[model samples]
Target: MFLEATWPLAPFVGGFCTVRHTLGVSQTPFDKFNVAYHVGDNADHVAQNRRTLDSFLPRSPIWLNQVHGGRVVDINESNISECANNQLDADGLFTRLTNTPLAIMTADCLPILLSNEDGSEVAALHGGWRPLHKNIIKQALRFFESSPEHVSAWFGPAIGPKAFEVGLDVVEAFCNDDPNYKGAFVRHPDNEDKWLANIFTLARMQLLALGVKNIYSDDLCTVEDKTRFFSYRRDKQTGRMVSVIWRKYP
Candidate 1:
């Protein structure tokens, strides 16, 4: 069975989406559609299943060597094959053309997708705590030729706010950057230095800062929903899920 699942987040662009969250029965968390080659799943099986994924879309999803940074790659026909080698560890992807899918693999981190409302351009981003701290979403916003008003965004499943805990450093990262983050974290009186961070709200803060009005989020939690989603924080050796998107053609 294909382990890929569709995003429940609203207003999917022509080909914008999230893949299914699944576990490999033999491989613990890496059993199903573990698109991450670095996670120790069998390489042959990963390739075989990748072909399985190819059958669902018009072309291969341009993959990445995710490094949790804010750098974005532009994908075009000339670089599709070379990209497989020089994806050179980027955290986000953008494309103005159709047919070539731009995608990412994530576990607990947010797999973010952006598309112009008229459907001429699209992108995929990886946002965990580090990249978020570095303003990766902001980098993405700058890539679009259109104003934020003409752009729409979709956020894939990530760890829920309630389940996400951090020390004072995490809270300080945002607060130091912008005091507007004061509302995004709640201090834990009993825990002393710990705070609860709302990743969804964190995402919304950036999207709004760019004047993007159409934002859709999957309230789904990778940590809590063990049956359907994988969580690196929950399971260290977990298989990663692919959240992919491509322009649709008639």
Candidate 2:
């Protein structure tokens, strides 16, 4: 039901990625445990699924109106109400407040959970290719009062390199940003004009370049793990699993 994030951080920081489970109410393509309402799942079913997930969380998560950009919202008591209403249009969320859970929903795009060494600050990012190319990870790290070396990051399940084929333009876009990113792509096995991109590697490169060292990642591939996850690339219309992070009250 949950793929808990395993990383070195103060015990107060908590995070996990939800997986599809038979117990949820979403039907057919959504199967079960689909918590996103914008994915064409039945509204009532989505609500029930969210409520069920909320039961395990300290507070209801602040869902984002993700646009696959670099914007990161600083979540605080002042704007918590608007964030709860899902009125924020951004791909990343950061907060220092205890019990305020931040969430990012995705099928194949990567979900990254981050926190300072002592767990005083935490953040969640939606790491689609567009956002990554736009330097979303860098944007989120800037919210931390701690330096990059004091930050730890955990990457959730995503479309792996073997299945994430892309065009020359995609490869060029990344390589143009930094030559180091060239290592994250290779010629597709079946198509010479296409390349298989490694989203995880690309994210790692960004984090490493920004001086963050304590990085951990899940090797699970959403496109290959049909039984445990949802994949939009595999199924155009599908449900979304959410990755959430928060710091418990001291």
Candidate 3:
């Protein structure tokens, strides 16, 4: 978990953001802590792992389908049952409801947790290259009444720029959106048609552009740290890590 800054929203209103590693009793690929259901891991083991995760929180988290798109869902107490019965097709989740953990799963994709000061609102985003190019961070912030300046963000573990190589089209997507994004990419030394994209840098640029002042990150690279994280780029059949954010009862 990335607990670097004294969680801008935790102290006042009792919300916190945390991440879980891929460590559980599931077999190879998933190994110990995979929380995703569609990843082909044993169903019973996945269920057990989810239960284990719930044991550490105030309540079960609201999990989504995570289509790597910019769709953000605002969850409240009223629709809690509906959300559970019908899985949401969104990549980002935010809530004002107390004790309802909003979670997003990721392997090599970036998991971002955002919250307002005093913990009145909190959100989590599953950011892959597609969502990043689409500016999902800005899209997620639109769910809250607060301005971007009043929000703080924490970036969970993901494939670092040195390990995340992308095609020229991705580079074009970013640069075409904004030329400032060009700095977030580096030409691959071996592959002429490929470039290394800095996911965190791209994310930071988006947040800052939107006027979000406080941003914290976990420097750990998922692709490089095989023991602590699961990387889709490194292992296509790997499990995903979950990052959850919620408001604690006062």
Candidate 4:
């Protein structure tokens, strides 16, 4: 849907595109569209899914080995030799070059896409609570050589605030770093010390702090919509969805 909206057989496939979803061969939840070999899915299915996804985009979606950390990597320096069967030490990727699609796979984690005012460069980041708490946005904001005001972002589907429950330690972790984090957390109804976090709300806070106000949010809750998206929080075992963005080749 993103590609169809962006480029439609424009100047041949010289730019980049992104895809998300874990691949599995006839697996219950991961029946198809799994792009990564991780998450206990069938490896061959993932490879085949990659081939199927190729038809929709100009370049292969550069995937990440997400570790729920704030580590962001420049695409030029990415260690492509690495495999993603296990936890990846990094969670975000950026690229200023064309034909390099930035993508992240997520079930419940937020998928973030960034673009400069001129649309010269693009990046994608996976933001679970861990990555958000770790300040991945701060890193991404720093990595952009362009002015912060010129940067625009799109927030994809994720586990909404109503669905996310966290312990006091989680709240304390954010507070310890900056008191501004407190605004993102709200007391959970059933649990005294627990909190219900709104990732969208927190993300806006973070982006505003980064000085990027042009933001678009899908407001889709993956956990709530089983048919359109995959949700890890709603179901422990599930497939992931790919969210991506990139510039076109002139």
Candidate 5:
């Protein structure tokens, strides 16, 4: 099933995050609704699941070969065919085309969806800590024809602060970018060298700093909710959930 994103986007824009439910074809650790073919799930099952998902979408989604970097591909009519044939190696995708859903697959990493106020442009980002530290949101924002103020962002489920622990290096990397980022990390209760990172807070801070005002979140923690999500940190071998957004065709 889907966890529909309820933001104030134009009626023509659609966005949602997929959940691992009993209705899917994947089995065992994947156990129903695993969408990524790179995750070692059966090819046929993944294909079937994608087909099932496609039935709900206007057109087949443009998936990426996410590398957890800041690269974002422009998905438009001219490059649409090439994009479908070659899963671009990038962490984000942007497109203004109608019904061309852009998807990002993740287990614990955040899935961030964006759209302009009038629903003319939409983007999907694979927001892992590496890409976030690299300011992937900032890169993705550049694709919007409008300024940051006119863009709204929807944050899908990811590893929450309480469950996402990191090292001093990670904290320093973010804080080095901006001392304000220090506020997003706190010393782990039992380990002085470790910190509990608030990815949601960090991403929100980045978006706000970039001048994006209308931000929304599902507030669901993938690590904590095993029934509805897949968490790589929690389960070493697991399936990936997808978050997608598109401008509906008239």
Candidate 6:
């Protein structure tokens, strides 16, 4: 139903991360566990699915509108109720409060979870190429209030480099920003200007450069795993899967 990632660095860094697949009661296309309300999934079905998700979580998760931008809001007691009714317009969420889960929805895009060594701070990011180009990860990192060396990150399911074909503009977006990023793209054999962009590699490079020494990726490609995930690039109108993270109380 869901995959979980546990933090082993410290007991105080107490939180668990998980991402759901299309393995629930949701109908076809959404199949099951479709959490996004904007994707035209039935409101009742989506609501019920969320309730099921809430049952597993200590507190309700903070859902975002996810405009593919870099803004990250800190979840607080007040924001939780507001987010339940109306989602926040941001690509990332971070919180220091315990039992407050932060969630990011994705389909072919990356869902990233971050935590500090002491388990005092945790964050979730929706990392699309657009936001990656905009430095959303860096934006999210700023809220950690800790040095990058003390932070650990986990990359969730996304379109793999081999399957994610792109135009020269996509290649240029990162390469133009930094020449070192050229390694993240490979020119397609059939098309001189076309390239295959590696989302995971790019994300790792960004995290490493930011001084984050501990980084991990699930290496699950949503585009290739039809049975487990929803890929907008693969299904076009498919529903989204969510990656959630939160710090538990000591």
Number of colliding residue pairs in model 5: 0
CA-lDDT, candidates in order: 0.75, 0.91, 0.81, 0.71, 0.91, 0.82
Where does model 3 exceed 4 Å of error?
A: 1-6, 12-23
If scored against the real structure, what TM-score would every candidate get? Answer: 0.89, 0.97, 0.93, 0.84, 0.97, 0.92
Residue 168 of model 2: what lDDT? 91
Q: Which candidate wins on lDDT? A: 2
Per-residue lDDT of candidate 3, residues 116-224 (tens digit): 8767788889888898777788888998898888899888888998999999899899898799999999999888888999999988999999999898876568899
For model 5, residues 205-241, the per-residue Cα lDDT tens digits are 9999999989998678999999999999999899999
Better of 4 and 5 by lDDT: 5
Model 6 lDDT, residue 28, Cα: 74
Model 5 CA lDDT for position 228:
93
Question: Sorted by lDDT, highest first, which candidate order results?
Answer: 2, 5, 6, 3, 1, 4
- Candidates 2 and 4, the one with greater TM-score: 2
Error of 3 at 232 (Å): 0.6
True lDDT of residue 249, candidate 5: 58
Q: Which run of 10 residues does model 3 get worst, by summed lDDT?
A: 14-23
lDDT of 4 by residue, 146-213 (tens): 88888877777889988988888988988898898899899998989789988888788888988988
Cα RMSDs, all models: 2.9, 1.1, 2.2, 4.2, 1.0, 2.1
lDDT of 5 at 38: 88
- Summing lDDT over every window of 10 consecutive residues in candidate 2, give the lowest-scoring window: 5-14
Counted clashes in each candidate structure: 4, 0, 4, 4, 0, 3
